[model samples]
Target: MRCPYCGSLDTQVKDSRPTEDSSAIRRRRVCPDCGGRFTTFERVQLRELTVVKRSGRRTPFDRDKLARSIEVALRKRPVEPERVERLINGVVRQLESQGEGEITSEEIGSLVMEALKALDDVAYVRFASVYRNFTEAREFSALLDEISGDGREAAVDEAGGERD
Candidate 1:
């Protein structure tokens, strides 16, 4: 690796370790000529994936774009950065595991909905409002009812008793 301090081509790795999240490898390097030290991180790029939009347009799958949307939904919530990273990783893994060159936007939205649901009910509702394109109060009420388990309780009451 080139030395950042002097732009020298003679740099040696002094130490290497995996980052806390295990998403990348951190390397400590030294420039022999200038005796300068610096750090660098390396991460693996598995493969390129494409997102097929609802309007039949295709674009490269962007992790940052996905993370930004989740962050917007999670704004002001008491969620940790680590948890958010894990959530994003989970969604990426799910998409990668599909092994398809292109995936539908609906599928991606469903994955995000599941992730947000497990993370926070409020965030889930927030994301669902935009993702599902809610226009009326009834739609929002239905989502709240579903998340609050009211729908399930009502179904059980209508059935006359709890399951044996």
Candidate 2:
């Protein structure tokens, strides 16, 4: 590891352990040349991801951005914070496990929509409105109808009974 203080390439790791969430490893390091100590956190990344935009522009995948979008959709909602974390983690894991270096923005949007759909109806509709670019009242009505139908079907299936 490179020392942040002296810009030295030689740094000795003194301690390493998994973080509380086990999402990353915390490492303590010291630079021999400058006698500087610093901490670093690292995570196991299967591969770096590039997001391919519909406009033919490519950008690096950002987990924070994804979280922010989800937060925006879930804003002022009654969902628990822990469930939100799990939802974000689940989406990220699905992306990483795809084993592809490049993913489309549409694919990411779809994944978030699915996660939100299972978590909260309001949040799901909130996200879908923006994701699907609803430009008219009819569009909103169509989406609401689709959502209601899906909910009824899910309820019937979960009850182990035929749909009435």
Candidate 3:
């Protein structure tokens, strides 16, 4: 490693430790030439997932993009950042498990909407409004109806399968 202070190429790792969450390594390095010490962090990088749009255009999957959309949806809401991270992680895991090189943008949006639905209703509605392109009240109403219908179906199924 090169020293940032003196730009020396001769450097040795003095100490190494895991970061708070253990997601990365914090390494203390010393430059032998200038005797300058610095800290560096090492993290694992995952392969990019490709997203195929409805227009047949393919783009790389971006976690930041997903997070930004979530932020917009959960604006002025009670959702936590950790919850959003977990939701995004779950979607990424599901996509990776599929072992497919590319996934549709619609599929990705659906995954986010499903996760948001469980986290916050207002957030879910906001996300669905933008994702589903709600240009009219009817469009938003339709989405509400669909969600309500699904909930009613689930309740009925659970009631029928109840024990005792």
How many steric overlaps are in each model, in order? 0, 0, 0
Candidate 3 lDDT by residue in tens digits, 78-133? 77666766776677777766778789998888888898899998899898877776
RMSD of each candidate relative to the true structure = 7.4, 7.5, 8.5
Comparing 1 and 3 on TM-score, the stronger one = 1
Please write out the lDDT profile of model 2 over residues 43-127, one tens digit for every residue: 7777899999988899999988999999999999999887887788788889999989999998999999999999999999899
Decreasing TM-score order of the candidates: 1, 2, 3
- Among the numbered candidates, top TM-score falls to 1
Error of 1 at 35 (Å): 15
Structure candidate 1, residue pairs in collision: none
Total backbone collisions, model 2: 0
Model 2: per-residue Cα lDDT at residue 39: 99
Taking all chains together, the TM-score of candidate 2 against the true structure is: 0.70
Q: Report model 1's TM-score to 2 decimal places.
A: 0.73
